[model samples]
Target: MHCFKEKICLIQIATDKEAHLIDPFEIKAAPFFIRVLESSDVMTVFHGADFDIRTLDREYQARVKNLFDTEIACRFLGVRERGLGALLKKHFNVDANKKFQAFQCGCQ
Candidate 1:
């Protein structure tokens, strides 16, 4: 989850157990989540953010105030990159190998 300006973006990577319990109703009723959506300065998330925004809108009637796409950021940065792993390797000097790189793909 991240907030920027008045927008809030939440990323939920569910494990097998947690994934099973996931439901639209529970997502809406989660009190803490509602609070985050209601009160945030800004939100920045990457690819497929629309899906998340749609789900939040459908379940809780929440609306994002401001949004920044990290994938777009990488492009604007002119690093000739697309995925998080490559960007991380370029900017953060992290050695994200093929195995871990594949795992990082789901982040966006």
Candidate 2:
């Protein structure tokens, strides 16, 4: 992980076999994360949120208000699968062909 304080850029370089290339400049300029933090009326939503929240908190000292967890929402809605891809497919008929699904397990 790399962070540039001057630019407020936080980056992660995946060195694993299925390493993904991300542009830190693009991420730094993306408005979604910061905009969600700054919004008073719009609540930040997440699914399987623990790690995400921790990273955002550590990196930006961001405090999320009115957080809605999709997994929890799925439970409330009685959905069979709470995984993001599964839920997306079931609800929105969207298919995400994830290439790095096993990247975290070092499986590449």
Candidate 3:
């Protein structure tokens, strides 16, 4: 459960070198898929994960283990703006505009 539209849609997997966008709608779930997500070894990271986590359970019927969310981190740090865009600008000095957060996805 990486990227989604309505249900789980595009799953983005990244390594040190590259990233892959997997279309879950096209691929049937592999046997170890849930195991992979719930595994204790790899950490699942998300920013503002409320919808994403809920979608994974409600839509994909899976639960994630070892979850880390930047929004939660921001809250832990006592930041007023816990949004990804705001955190990025404050901590990393990256200015990712907030206009696209509400924009519709999976459309031209």
* Cα lDDT listed for each candidate: 0.55, 0.63, 0.73
lDDT of 1 by residue, 46-93 (tens): 453666677677756776656667877766778566776777778799
Which window of 10 residues has the lowest lDDT sum in candidate 3? Answer: 1-10
Per-model TM-score versus the true fold: 0.44, 0.58, 0.70
The best candidate by TM-score is 3
Q: In model 2, which runs have C-alpha deviations exceeding 4 angstroms? A: 1-35, 100-108
Please list the residue runs of candidate 3 whose C-alpha ends up more than 4 Å from where it truly belongs after superposition.
Answer: 1-5, 29-32, 92-108
Task: Give the Å shift of residue 93 in candidate 3.
Answer: 4.7
Where does candidate 2 have its weakest 10-residue lDDT segment? Answer: 1-10
Q: TM-score of predicted model 2? A: 0.58
Model 3 CA RMSD to the hidden true structure, in angstroms: 4.8
Alpha-carbon deviation at 101 in model 1, angstroms: 10
Q: What is the lDDT of residue 99 in candidate 2?
A: 82
RMSD vs true structure, all candidates: 10.9, 9.6, 4.8
Tens digits of per-residue lDDT, candidate 3, 38-100, equal: 888978888888888788787657788988887788788898987777778787999996674
Candidate 1 structure, TM-score to reference: 0.44
lDDT value for candidate 3?
0.73
